[model samples]
Target: MDKYPYTPGHRGIETSIAAAIDINPKLGRLQRVSEAAIRDAGTQGLTADELAAKLGQDRCSIQPRTSELKRLGIIIDSGLRRSNWTGKSAIVWIIAPMLNSGESPSQ
Candidate 1:
């Protein structure tokens, strides 16, 4: 028996969550939109408007969902400061690690 049943991949978290969302169409759409926003922003960061435009969504719709996604740990926020923006619009998000079954990394 192999000690490691699954080969770790760089795309693990995104791939797994995406697969889960696929079974639930509503979740799939939300994840896709959020993922695209993170991708488009890259490292420069994105405001709500920017993300909304990129995902073809209204600002109101994107903001709350993005907040929810961040809380879920599916996305990570840099929490950095913006040059001129007055709110938390400068947050940069990325797909975070997905821990293996029965395993947890030290914080």
Candidate 2:
């Protein structure tokens, strides 16, 4: 069984909930693609918009995967903001730094 890292909120309309459930099976693969896209951005990192553009994907499809990645500590907010398409400032997401000296980052 493939246990997902996150699930949709129950408060949405039935169709939305159903859509989320339908996408559950693919989230892991999508997360991997999103993760790699963010990682490939290197030290400059990437805004969610930049990532969606790089992946040629809808931002809505990508955001949930990013949320899961952040929960897993696979990525972090870079403390930097970049102007998005609509001129609003957006967070920069970066791959979380690896721990040194054999320390587990989550612990």
Candidate 3:
């Protein structure tokens, strides 16, 4: 007789950790807003104000969300630099890919 073990759902510990990270209930809302902004950006990308407007959130909320997303490796910050407009620095951000095929889903 061969024995087989049952595997849990697609995500186990990761899901738990993500839930735990949301110590503040608003964190989830912020994350969703960030995700929506990223989705709206698509290949074009967006600035902080653009993201905030797209998500219907204030810059204060969007900034923290962007920081958290960057911490989670979901987004990359290109740092602030001069834009086409004078006296204005543009902070570019890029959304990272969810996963790499060769990389395992679990840590």
Q: What are the models' TM-scores?
A: 0.49, 0.80, 0.57
Q: How high is the CA lDDT of each candidate model?
A: 0.52, 0.79, 0.57
Off by over 4 Å in 2: 1-4, 7-10, 99-107
| Candidate 3 error regions (>4 Å) | 1-23, 78-87, 98-107
Q: 1-107 in candidate 2: lDDT tens per residue?
A: 33445553334789877878877777778888988988888779898888888989888777777777887788889999999888999989988886223445577
Instruction: Please report the candidate that would top TM-score against the real structure.
Output: 2
lDDT of each residue in 1-107, candidate 1, tens digit only = 21111111123588764643443435447556776667556665565556776778766556555665555555556565453234553655554444212233333
| Candidate 3 lDDT tens digits, 12-85 | 48865464344355766667667666755665666676677777777755666666666666666545443523
> Sort by lDDT, best first: what order?
2, 3, 1
Worst 10 residues of 3 by lDDT: 1-10
| Structure candidate 3, residue pairs in collision | none
